[model samples]
Target: MTTSPPASATPALPEPTPTQSEQYSLTHGKLTVGDYLPKASHDGKPGAGKCEWSSHVSVALTSDEIGALAWVLIDSVMKARFGPAVQLYDVWREHTLDGTTIPEPDRQTIGSFVKPVFGLPGADKKKSKDHLHGHIGEWLWHLLTKDNPTVRAQPAPKGDVTDSGGDGYTIYETANSELRFRLWESKKNTGKGSLSTSLNQAYGQLGEHGQTYVAKIVGAYAQASGEGAAELNSFITEIPRAWTQGDVIVGAGVTLATHRPLPNKPFKKMAGKLPLLDKPGQLRGLATSIECYEELADTVRRYAWTAL
Candidate 1:
């Protein structure tokens, strides 16, 4: 009879390959994208009626995987930046392109370099709450678009600070490849009141300032270059007319911090809120609920510094 190998001599199990859902464009080399948020479920039959919306459960990330997802989200926005951050990002990108894992020391160095820009591990309570709410809302919207093959979204805001314009912008390509633009507003419910309070606020804000918001996004694209920039700019010029013709889509998403059961049709009641967007293919909504929301914010902050 043969004896078993000693612990040190036993072969180690190989790491499991990540599934398609767990992978992202930035998750190359040894970087693994974590399953932080659950697979989103359509609130109802999307596209069967007027508005489209989806729902998500509480985030499921421990300290183990939070950092990986945090890094991926940050990297996505970093694509639209310049200077030192881009330099650091390029270093990481080189490793991805080379199909090699970043060394532990380099990982720590890069993490430390970018941590302050993101306002991670924020000390001020109010600032931290606002930061988490705004960033997470924008991020969720960005992720939602990723699930739909026909939609291409602009990058989320790069940092913890919220901008004065719309929370997101997306281009939805129809079956024949005609592009339709969507302006999105995202909010978080931190008060003791209902999620509708936050969503209603988003609705009103979009109704009042939506045009100005769209203008800002279009202006930002004016500085863009590269192959498709001109084609994209042409589409941008049509947004005003599109808005008048009811071809543009307006969307609002809210993140609720509670354990209570959510409404089966959360956005149906708001059908009349934005009349222009009430019709088929014109309005979109998303509702994400999380337990211990503040705790998750703190955890995201802490794990962002994990490599350091």
Candidate 2:
């Protein structure tokens, strides 16, 4: 067998020359959206004020682009659950300080949607209000404006820090556990629900065996029948993090309407969506292959896996 080249000077990812479509990854704070909802937030229930917390995602794409992504989000939602939820979010981004609305002519590109989760061994175990819908807005603002880098937690605790504060949701993570499109931590209640407890509580609702793909596209809240993914015994699995290394990411699913489903494509398209786990000899090298990363993403998109 041919020996791999000496480990040195891996080629760097090419910097794409500036294009109108590529405007510095569109920092949320700089964009009209940030003026509306600057950071990931727990704005709590929906309201009549400029912002609404109904199930949704805050996308950074133009109107047309939103439509394409919406289509895909809807597709993934359908495949994940029996069908789409009662309402979908499109149009009506929060109003900016200057009192202008960020046009979401196609509002479906922020990311996937998730259902409101409830019913675990020790959770309240009661139905919540319609106000509890879920969300999945882009972490654009934080990565663009905030001095601190965006964060993500890994396996056992597996989630990307797609947190753009002021928007109302963040994802917490774990190994073999499905990532949570989380709510901003609340200092209001303390007991089983300080920040850490509340997160763990929400995670358990998805159930250990669920492969449901239905999640709110922008913010959390969609209580329906379903199961939770897995749970890691340790509170500290892979802690929250950011991408220190570079990797490529490609859209796995399709986009549609002003809103669509999220990624859940075949295995070979979404692997590097997050950091890879370096399992011994076999699982190590494959991490570098985009196809493998894509496959890994596809494999886990359904639901977090549980130990047998």
Candidate 3:
């Protein structure tokens, strides 16, 4: 009864500001997403301190050892088109540029060539999880592991006593998975540089549980560190920039088999939960299929060796 006219109704609270999209240009001028360029056009040349990652080839899989991953997947709703595989070389031979071999992987040949199940599941699923999983224990106990390639034995010049040193390797997706292991090719000949393989020594470089859901690229790009100096140069400069470079919206140019996956927005908003597969390029960056797998092999093949 005391107050004159009711105080002027307060203006309705301004609608909350919209989120800055990572995929498209922003509507309001002030905000924006990272780059959305193609993977090839973004990642610039890595300098000495920047940690360059070049290889003759790369292969990605969604697997827990026992070889490349076997995802129960297909490619029908395919939208973000994959670039055609550059037909410069035969994919298989290209993958072997670093002297690695898949061998004549028919059933018989593969059986003999397989070193051992190692940390992966056995050809038999139940047995694999029970036996191999147990044996791997603390080391391979990560949620999203990868079998990244490294030189089994560092190749020597001519035949200087022929020291058969090999590359080491390791798995990542969580925890100390970035570890490397060195092993000898000729365990009996224990010379100074004896042949051996071990996990890469970068385990401590990342967080025990890094955020990137790298466990997805299983369908294609077996995560081979096999890009050639130049081809790798092409990728770093192009894709990373598109995926997450400067002003433009970059593609993140991540491979499908990267241990980390991209993040998703729409799903999180509606479901009120964050999903590993919800990330932008999370499920994977590459398309998966028999052909694409082979194409990945081809791409690595071409990148590894120039003549091929």
Cα lDDT tens digits for candidate 2, 161-192 = 22322222333432444343222211111113
Tens-digit lDDT track of model 3 for 1-308: 67675588765532111111101123322111011111222223422212212111123322121111110000100000111323212232233333343334332332221212221123432232222211121111111112224322121111111222221112212133222121111111111221111111112111121222112111222333553434322332332222221112111111111111222211112111112212322211121112123322222212222221
User: How do these models rank on lDDT, best leading?
Assistant: 1, 2, 3
Error of 1 at 82 (Å): 6.0
RMSD values, in order shown? 8.5, 23.6, 23.8
Model with the higher lDDT, candidate 2 or 3: 2
Q: Candidate 3, TM-score vs. the true structure?
A: 0.19
Assess the local accuracy of residue 97 in candidate 2 as a C-alpha lDDT between 0 and 100: 15
Consecutive 10-residue window with the lowest summed lDDT within model 1: 13-22
The candidate that wins on lDDT is 1
lDDT of the structure predicted as candidate 3: 0.20
Task: Note the Cα lDDT for every prediction shown.
Answer: 0.57, 0.23, 0.20
**Per-residue lDDT of model 1, residues 1-308, tens digit only:** 99988878967543222122125323533242224555457755445335677677654544334434554554454444334566667765555434355688776666554444355233432344565655655665565455578864465554544557877777768677777787777777755778777777777877788878877877776444786566666777888656655554444333333333467777765556767665556677767665545554454443333333
TM-score of 2: 0.18
Best by TM-score: 1
